[model samples]
Target chain A: MESWRDNRFVFWLLSLPGTFWISLFFIVPLSVLWIYSFGEKTGITDVAITWTGQNYGRVIEPVYLQIMWKSLWVSAVSTLICLLLAYPIAFAICFAPDRWKPILLLITILPFWINLLIRTYALLAVFRTNGYVNKAIGWLWNGIDWLFGGQHPFQPLELLYNNGSVIAGLVYVYLPFMVLPLYATVERLDKSYLEASLDLGASQLRTLLSVTVPLTMPGIVSGVILVFIPSLGAFLTPALLGGANAIMIGNVIETQFKSANDWPFGAALSFVLIYATFGILALRWAITARSKGVEF
Target chain B: MAAVLWNRTPQGPLEYSRRLWLKLLLFATFFFLYSPIAVLIAFSFNTSKRNITWQGFTLNNYVVAWNNPDLLDAFTNSLIIAFCSTLVSTLIGGMVGLQLWRFRFPGKTAYEAFMALPIVIPEISMGVALMAFFIRIGWLTSDVGWPLNLGPIIVAHIAFSFPFVSIVVRSRMVGFNVQLEEASRDLGANQWQTFRYVLVPFMKPGLVAGALLAFTLSLDDFVITYFTSGPGSVTFPVKVYSLVRRGVTPDINAASTVLIAITVIATVLAMKLQAPTKAAKG
Candidate 1:
């Protein structure tokens, strides 16, 4: 009985620090944000606590709507591209020889450790006009000129400061996020199923489609979510690579908090984004649950 | 019969093409991932300050980065924040991991979920929410509120990194053998002695790994720091970001190359430590 009491005391002592820090810094702040969303902005740093839904209604304006749509589609395309690129890499790593598997996985996650800003800067240097890429292209052009007796100088394509570059940056940054989770799932797959499919007269492609894809669907879904969420809220990539025209919802939220002096509107915008993201997650869960024939 | 049928089937053109396609895809994916970083490192050596066009090679860029006072200050600030947060969070996280692993209590599931929540949510949400909470409660500014500086930034770092440490330590504890603890206790060792002599040695990998992860995450953080930090507290990533915005320079490239070197070395060490632990488990 005395030992049981001591154990309880020890448990409380152990749990206090983490619970206190998280409650103070994370949970309270989130609740505070939820409360602020319903208040009205009175001044630059002050807000009135008159409960109003006007801030949320502003989210439907055409400009905001257009930005939201662009953010969604751009993120979707990046997620798709990352999925396509990562699937094979994940497969290769999973099936690699035992001695090499860890090294291969390590290489895939190495880029993730590098600063995102630095990586974007690298992309910027590579894709800049008269940069390394264009210089190489110009060299090739000179070769073509020498071959064909044509003397037109090569012109650099407009690669940076556009939607395409933004998407490219997003895909590069998020590819490891996609690959790691997919590798986790694919590596753990039972190999006998592949053997059974092959033995049943299925070709490689047929077996991959019928066996591998379905089994790795959960990974694909998770990879999509992981890539998509960060891409949707990406401010740095679009700001650095997309120039002035390719602003995202994240840029708007950032401006509101930093320079726009409209905290209420920013809070409302954030809540909208949070709701949409959570709603999608909940919906996906429901669909997955239903598909698995498990009722809740 | 199956052997005869397998011998009769020859590798077809389609199979050959498919194999070639997969090989090309894998090659392209690796090239895409690696070439930019390689180019970045190479250009850091170029003497030119303007474009990435070939210039005379020199190590002057590294010297420039090393000489910049603002960059050095930012680097110092980042180190301080990373160290403090890593220390506090590791201590807290070790305890949390122990409690979660060795004890059963009411609301354990809910507590676990709460621990993992910060990791799953978008960083922007966490950043803005904290900003809102800080400002609304009069903690951000000194005029009408509390004086804010590195305090909020450190708190935010500790908040986010706490989960990472807890998760890693919990996984390590899950693999730990309970017999060692019981044996040590049976031999008349006290709780502190058992923890020091037996548990600490056993949990060293997880503790080191968790601390390293927390430190790295604290160092790499920009968005959360940007929101929570006040003037004069800009971290290294924040400084690099502002520099990138100002213009492209070989000095920035040099700085990034240094950053990349540190992170790569750390990651390799982490993998080395983690590999043995994982292998032993299986």
Candidate 2:
């Protein structure tokens, strides 16, 4: 009894700091999410408290619907690209010699901890007209001119502010997240099952279809969800590298608050995003869990 | 069966093709990752009217960028804010993690999940909400009310970063053997002494890691800081963004290269030091 009392005391004491922060910062803000979504806009910036679904109604308007559709399409493409890129890298690391595995994983993850803003700017330098690729092209043109041809040559494509740039930035930023979980999932997979398929005289392609893909479904699903969720909300990369036209839902939400001076609408937009992301994530989790049970 | 996408194995003839494919894939990936970063680093040293055109190799931009007084001031402000917030949140999170890890309580799971939610939620919402809250209560400006002003900015940073600290620290606490605490008490060491000499030492790595994450997040933040921070409270990233949006200049490139170098070095050092602690999700 005495020991249990001491345990209780220690537990309660340790929990105090986390509990305080969660209540004061996190829980309060999240709870206020629904409130903000329904509140009324008074002055341009201020959201007056009055319950209504008017904001949700406006979310269905064609212009806003277009923005939402674009956001969805971009996120879907980004997720698909991230999955294609991450899967093999994850497979290689999982099967690599144990001594080499850690280093490779570290290399894969190294770029992630660097500030995203800086990384995005780095891409900016590369994509700019007079940047390194252009300079190298100029050098090559001069070389060709000196050797055989007469005059100077072609120009930089100016890849900035394009969909390609935005996709590049997202893939760069989120690649490691996709890789890490896939590696974790792949490493734990048993190899004996593959050997059994081979013994049955099935082709590698057949075994992969019948066995490996089925096992790694969770990783692929989770990876898709992880990449998709954040891409939907990205503001800075789209704002900087994506230029004006490729505006995301996050940029739309920001406009509501800053430029549009429509706080209630901004709040509504945020609530919509949060709901959509969480709702999709939850559905995926449920499906995965159900599959796990069936597999068991 | 090589499930290139569907299976994890290569067929007899496809094995060679697959190995060649992996090599190409790895090279392409590494190129995709490093080319942009290399461009930024290279341009920092370029001497030209145009940052894009290489007139000659020089350190002119670095010299000018570093010498700027406002940039220096912004760096100092960011450092101070990050350091303070990291320390405070680490301590707070450490204690909370210890509690949750050690005992059962009502609402524990809900709280744990709630604490973890900040990581996945959009930072913009958290930043704006905190800014709104501070304004409504008159905690924003010294002239309006409150005996002291750490300013609304610091409060906002502390609030947003609080979740990161707790989640990281709590996960660290989860892996430590609870038997140590029981053994310490059995040996006659009191609770405080056991925590001071043993439990804290064990928890130190996670706490420090959590602190590092908090510090970096605070330093790199722009959207959050823009809303919460007052005049004279610009973070380095926010300053860089404004500078970038205005125009492309060699000075910004120099500044960016230095910042990237710091982050890269810090990340490598942390990874090296903590390699053996049973790697967990990032």
Candidate 3:
């Protein structure tokens, strides 16, 4: 049993380094961002500051609002796909033999060590016009195309650089984020409650819904937070896979900082992104508590 | 009853279902994870200079990327930067982790939250801020006596890497018992002796794991390095990015294949070293 004083001293000391670093870099910079959000971008090539809320007002404009909507939609699509993909995997890993479970988990982790850029580029090898996918499709449609000579069957799936590809990219990028937390939760699940339900003649689907799913809701919520935020702020997948058409909030932020000469507006956008992130984290905390039946 | 289905007669439905489905799923899952790397390795040997394809096989791409002084130098810089970032972050993060474990203090919750903010906050924000900070601070400016180069790149790399080391180490440290420290004190050992003999031995695994993670992160990082770095500090990822933008060559694929091989090897070795601790946790 430790005294209050001892605990306080330890925490203060332990926290000092971290606090100092964050305050210097994260806190001050964010504060600057917050303040800049209120300021105006008023210069030609270099933004000169003049404070105003007109930047917030412009967020209501169709262009900015549409960008926000697109970001939300892409993030939602990715989150939905991740949930569909991860639930079964988590379920499978849980039921996997103890000797093989860790090995499977490590396999999922292999992509993280592989360069993210390299992984994204691998999509190129498969989806390229002359790649295996097209070649295989061409094999199926070769007779028709060869006969017609007008290029009807297997025209190489001109489906690249659109919402579908972008969605696929998001799904591929964030799938692991969904898996890690879900894996942690499922691994610790008590099997007895499940068995008792089955013994009482509950259907497989019912047992999953009533016993297993609700029990792992925390993992789901955390996974959503993990996947949703990154997808919302994503730039790489959209830029590489989607096109100029598939810009998101993060791309906007990058443009403002790098080229648009609207630091104040950029700062404002970042503040909004930051606030949205914090809002989600807070909402997750609240929802998790509520799900567990906590009053607070 | 189902046992008979999988017997020597090959009629066992239940045993067949269990074995077949599980094996198939396992294979599919591993293929999903690893097929991308396999594809990259295969493509690296593609001989066609225009439009990537397997035009028979050749190691010419590897020979080219390896022979290029610029790309090889970038790879060396990445290695050096990752090593230094891991070293510094490990030291600082270890100290912070210990302090958290050993001493109780006010504002601890605040500290914890502050530390975690970096993880939740977008990386681009950090990049922009570091860039602005570097320009404002004379040390990074080319006009200043110091050159714009690897020094600033390393500083930026270590900055984020430290927090990771601290976060992982702190979680482990919190669960560690204080009895060892008390026992060491009772045995009349000084603070340094107690730490070096007792505390450090226990913390060795966590520290190493955290450092390895930090190293990989620094090596992989691009956005932060892009903003903070000068002409001389180009990392492997950035080099790859530029290569890709210039219409990706087979050499890029070969270089990437080498990188993937190295990372997998390193991660496996690190996992093997940490296996006992991980098993104990299990």
Query: Best candidate per TM-score, number?
Result: 1
Q: What is each candidate's DockQ, to 2 decimals?
A: 0.46, 0.39, 0.42
Per-model CA lDDT versus the true structure: 0.83, 0.74, 0.74
Angstrom error at residue B87, model 1: 0.7
Candidate 3 lDDT, tens digit per residue, A1-296?
34447556545655566567657766665666676667766563234456788777776689988998999998998899888778777777767767877877887767867667777777655666766657768787987678878477556775457777778777776778888888888767787788888789897779889988888888888888889998888776776677687888888877887777677777777777778888998999888768883121
lDDT of 2 at B173: 75
Residue-by-residue lDDT tens digits, candidate 1, B1-282: 443354345644222222445557777877778899998898899987784566888999999999998898788888889888999989998888877887876677888988987886778878999988877676676443222366778889999998988888888888888888999999999998998999888888998888888888898888898888766677888899888888888888898898888777777787778878888888
Stretches of candidate 1 exceeding 4 Å from the true structure: A1-6, A140-152, A287-296, B1-18, B137-139, B143-148
Which window of ten consecutive residues has the lowest lDDT sum in model 3 chain B? B11-20
Over 4 Å off, model 2? A1-8, A30-33, A133-155, A293-296, B1-18, B139-151, B279-282
DockQ of 3: 0.42
Model 2 chain A — which ten-residue stretch has the worst lDDT?
A: A1-10
lDDT of 2 by residue, B1-282 (tens): 234564365444323224656657867887888887776778788887476666778998989988997777667777777777777777776676666666665676776677667776777676666655655555654363221243565556666676777777677777778788899989999979998988888888888777777777777777777666655566687788778787778888888777777667766665554655766533
Question: Which lDDT value does model 3 have at A17?
Answer: 64
Error of 2 at A130 (Å): 3.0
